[model samples]
Target chain A: MIVIGSESRGSVPNTSPNVRDMAQVSCCQLDEEEFRKCCLQLLQRSEELRDGWSWQQPQGSEDGYLKKTTLRCVSVTSKRSKKNQQDSALLIDSDCRQNQSAHVSAAPEEATDDADDEDVADDADVPACSACESSFLQFEYHVVFSCSYSSPVLYFRAFTLEGRSLTLEEVWSSIHPNFRLHLQENPLNAVSQQEHPLLGQPFFLLHPCRTEEFMKPLLQMAQQHHRSVNYVLSWLSIIGPVVGLHVPLQYFSTVCVKDPASSSNPG
Target chain B: MIMNNDKDVLRDVWFGRIPSCFTLNSDEVTEREAEPYYLMLPRVSYLTLVTDKVKKHFLKAMRTDEVEEMWFEYEGTPLKWHYPIGVLFDLHASASALPWSIIVHFKSFPDRDLLHCPTNSVIEAHFMSSIKEADVLKHKSQVVNDMQKKDHKQLWMGLQNDKFDQFWAMNRKLMEYSTEEGGFRYIPFRIYQTTGDKPFIQKLFRPVSPQGNPHTLCDLLKEMYPAALTNDGEQKRYQVLIHGIEPLLETPLQWLSEHLSHPDNFLHICIVPVPTD
Candidate 1:
């Protein structure tokens, strides 16, 4: 009933599971930089379809066959900063995303200078149609890369793949059947279009609050466990499809890699 | 302790024995394909559990920093920590079923993380089964000294007799020895064995329902063996007992789940016919 792992401060500990860090301690402990490097590796691997975070989408056939066009969690990133700005640059990235719909270069527009000092909420919340200048921003689940956290989050915006981004209707239709209800209720997945801290665009963010809970154990494993893991690939493998991004596994083996150094007895 | 290692008889299918049941696609992905985000859980969630070593490996494999509880759940119920994958598979005819699905919770991501793995996971199950097999082999043999054996017996008897107070009174002694492990805490695992089948070792922690209904062993049996209630019935009835003592028929499963949360506690199924007029 007490459910140990209280992280008791190493004194005359009340319970064995109650170490000072066990409850809060992560099994893996890579820092931000190290995590970034790991994610970077996976980002590249996912691009080449070398990592296992993606798979080929099968076609309808009498004779089974897999198409070369694979269904994978593509690691998407915006250029670093508004030339080192912040979420405001991400704002242009979102616009660039809209421009993508018109076959225009999605490069962050230079017009988006630091004039963002005004009430960002004045017109920022609504994504305007680049050509129309009146239509609101249509955010799609573009899926983003975070340099600081070195993790991939469910970033959404308008003008996704196939030129234009998924319309709200398309997004609603494409959402995983199981995740739809929770997507509505999960405060974490709630649609909060804002400027990305690094990309500076009005992208819909897959809330990171609840995400922290899941990452805690993973980080600890990176720190405590002996085997090296591709934290980004794992994160995408675990979180990508929430909005329907399917990443295939690269190493298609069924072996649990054991640390030759750490295995004796776990009693 | 009448262990039935179905692993031998039902091994090949798991090792790629083409079933006479259906033809397969050589190029296309099967029901169990390589998926990154989701894990495929077995239809029987309560059936199997991963070993700690593999649990660590699985966490590492995810390549995420999400905090994962060292436990896996099926429909929100955590599997007992001690269940070896083979034992769980045997209970569920897994060899024939081959490759049951696995469930991994994204612990920190409460809302979106809790998911039913879309594709059945091979690496997780393989890791679990292999680690368990290895652990079993490593011990080769165990000597629980006569004194400890007697102590264990008393504990078993207390369970058989349904003496909750007496059983726990002595359980502490066993736990004290393992406390130096990280801190003195209750061990994980609550196993249920039944006379219905000879040592069909299965573990599932059935938490109480919110409306206040304790899921009991009887409920589990009904769920596990649905055909037991025949439509052609002629006054056929059944009784459920734990250890040897009949538990209160309506005893909430939550009660059992809580009382037997420890790794050592076991509920062996011992069924017998009660006399009737």
Candidate 2:
């Protein structure tokens, strides 16, 4: 049964050509609380992925097929989308319900063992996690793949803000509010007609791991040397060839906070 | 003697020093022919100073021709110096004795290879000139004669209108500035090399508005010169100016800088020096 509801595109009136093509990850059947919770987890997952941590299964296991759970894919079919946008966001909800029904149905037919059902439930409860879904999506079929709802639709929109055409990153940040909204709204839509190459002007993506431990020293160093961390970090990225330093943003952030002068900041 | 690896060797020399004052305080100072004089404390990477008198006397005596070699006891261990003049002078004049300490100060130069070191206080020079009014008419005829050598379509497309003339004029102005007092001259040397291309080292440059005041320039320069520049809450306009432009940057900068007035225009003519021996 297809349930269609009123989906407001929100206050940002400008629509991205790519957005129409991006497969709409089914935001269906989820109540307000479930939707919110799913989004929160997605945001947290984005942070995790940004920090270089991969989603992986816990060790010492067997028959990983037992770990299989289904996720509902919502293909936002716009002519611009490159692939059918799959909604990994609804995978956990679907998989959990599927497993629950299976266990209920299987309980009566096979009176094999009490422990077996518990184990089956446990295996079935794999919850269609972010890492798993992403791995599955790596296969050609899944446009938007990932077990966990971390990797959302790749949304692309353009607007003139502050007298300049907003970059993809800037628009993403502005529309998403914080990382939470980004988790719920997978913006990268697949193109139905022509392949949309993801390329645009550069903008800063707020790193998930930014902590006081890192930024304080950096800010202090900036004040001392009278330089900005953004400038320094950007310079470091460019100068890597000349300076021969693998200055990733996280490392730069760490160095900045470690500066002694950072201690003087008013918290 | 030429210090093979000046920077690395200097670091070793500064950090690997013999502590004299602590030994004397422990009553471990043995009665020898020459007593230990003063301890050397570091003030900067290139300089150090003596802090104690006994270590100084020992260092002074060691420098003399009379004493071929002198032995002293520190921490109940016998130590001897054999004409270690450099260490002795460093100990006496200045060593490590600052708030941040010399080690911290020297930390800034690790990425700055020796090639960047200004060998002498001298300015280097370069010159380029645009064809004058007399040369322009003659140059046009010569251009027609040399049309076969040049890409006709490209040349015509580029010089279709007065825009090309404006560009030529602006380039002439830049050439003029480059030939002036503070301008590009010395090519960057490298610490190492794979091929001929030298890697570019990043140096920050303070932003100067067209009508920027001297005060603003100084402030911008202060932040720009540092390897790390951070934006404070206060309004500040500064940019990272890449050194040494490569052919790869041509199209990117054309799109990036837009008009010559944009900050991206400042990137042209930057020379990224290779950091090799």
Candidate 3:
């Protein structure tokens, strides 16, 4: 089942060869040097990404070793607006029913948000909307280069506003329903808590074993089109949305202006 | 004879054990003094997977309310259960005396230094992920990707149950390579050092040189960690240990990876300061 799902996911980029008129080149895989260069380009091109993400070279590591890019305290607001509040409420309601003790404390505000809406409506002049009762989650994401896969793996951890870490269930609930379905379809490559390679802290990471498998076709299309794509930007644009790290469309537009020097360089 | 030697090395690496004593922390409110538990820990196994008996023994002395998730500490450092038992020992307490003394804590779990191991499933997931990562380095993940889910389970269950024959039966496939390629595409290894705050050093390293010369342990150290090696006539400052023994620097990386790797299939080398005595 997973194999079929991954194959279909891999083919999505192949079908859409002409994503944009912009000349964006992508690499099949990145070496350490290319990863560093791409990270610089990502930060330079995108201001929002730059504010959150910083290159962290672990102390005591020798020069030329792989450095990680980290983005801390990124706020992802999952709004349960009036239109979709019923669906979301049902989801949370079922969750509470199944695991009453475990999830009640973690999502008390969310569980009671609907009930409190009446009181909030009576007290406030403005119309009470579910958006006002939206739950906010903060995520810390690290982009570390995997030498084995020759790709950047995303390691992240989500926390509540009160500083408690979210369990895997809570994290899944926070993901956008669309991306959640796709992630659920391919559970093997889905987010899992693992020890951080550099920090030794438990952080959730998307397994990179299949990254090269899915990325090859996407990169090849860009290469064949004679477009110069930033590997990190292209990869992140596809993956980041699944975990709420949306790469602004402006990043692509800015990077689309081809640099003459990089264009001439061979893959 | 060469094959026999290889088998013997693999057996020796698999059977390596560390004798340990687990004593409850002094501050815990116990009904009575907790008896120190002694056990021979399997070098390749994870601490969380094999220490249920130790947890049970210590829990008997303490009230249920007083107890929390159990954690282990050696000296001042909290032992990370995710690391192989041997790597933890060699990295932190290699020079310590026999019957490695470990403090068992029932309270104040160090969330910063340790990952919570609530169940064996966590260990299994971590163990499988590691093998998958290692395979990506070895054969571009071809061997592991082609494996049936049942085959993967056999490897994990073997390690969990301490069955050498069951593990090697499936693992031998992951270690194979074409004669033309000579060795694994890249040797999966992590060089650990005690002095650094860094977790470990991992990078792409080929088991064979471009000229078809096999890379030895010395060649790897020279490229990745030159500080671990000593110059001729210079005093040796560090010992390069695999499976708690210093194999000759001339030992081929391919052979060591094949025979000396833990169940997770990575060559875990600890570069510790040599004992002055």
User: Which of the numbered candidates is closest to the native, going by highest lDDT?
Assistant: 3
| lDDT by residue (tens digit), candidate 2, A50-123 | 42211221222110110111211211112222232421121111111111111122121132444465644553
Candidate 2 or 1, higher lDDT: 1
For model 2, the superposed segments whose C-alpha errors exceed 4 Å read A1-50, A53-77, A80-267, B1-166, B178-182, B185-277
Which docking category, incorrect, acceptable, medium or high, applies to candidate 3? incorrect
- Sort the predicted structures by lDDT, highest score first: 3, 1, 2
Q: Give me the displacement of residue B88 in model 2, in angstroms.
A: 59
Mind giving the per-residue lDDT tens digits that candidate 1 earns over A1-267? 223333444453443221323223234333444544543454344444432221211222111101111121222323343322432111121112222122122322212445543423433433343443222332233333332222445565443322233323334434555666776773324434333333323344555434545776776676587645665556656776665445555522311242223221111
Every prediction's TM-score for the first chain? 0.45, 0.17, 0.61
Encode model 1's per-residue lDDT on B1-277: one tens digit a residue: 1013522311221122111111111232233432323233221112223133334444554534433333344334343323333333333222243234435443422211122222223223222222222211111111112125455555555533435456555544332211322211211222333232122323222333334344555565565543333335455444333322355645554344323222233333333333354
Off by over 4 Å in 1: A1-25, A28-30, A47-151, A160-170, A189-191, A215-227, A251-267, B1-277
Best by DockQ: 3
Per-residue lDDT of A54 in model 2: 15
Give the winner by TM-score: 2 or 3.
Answer: 3
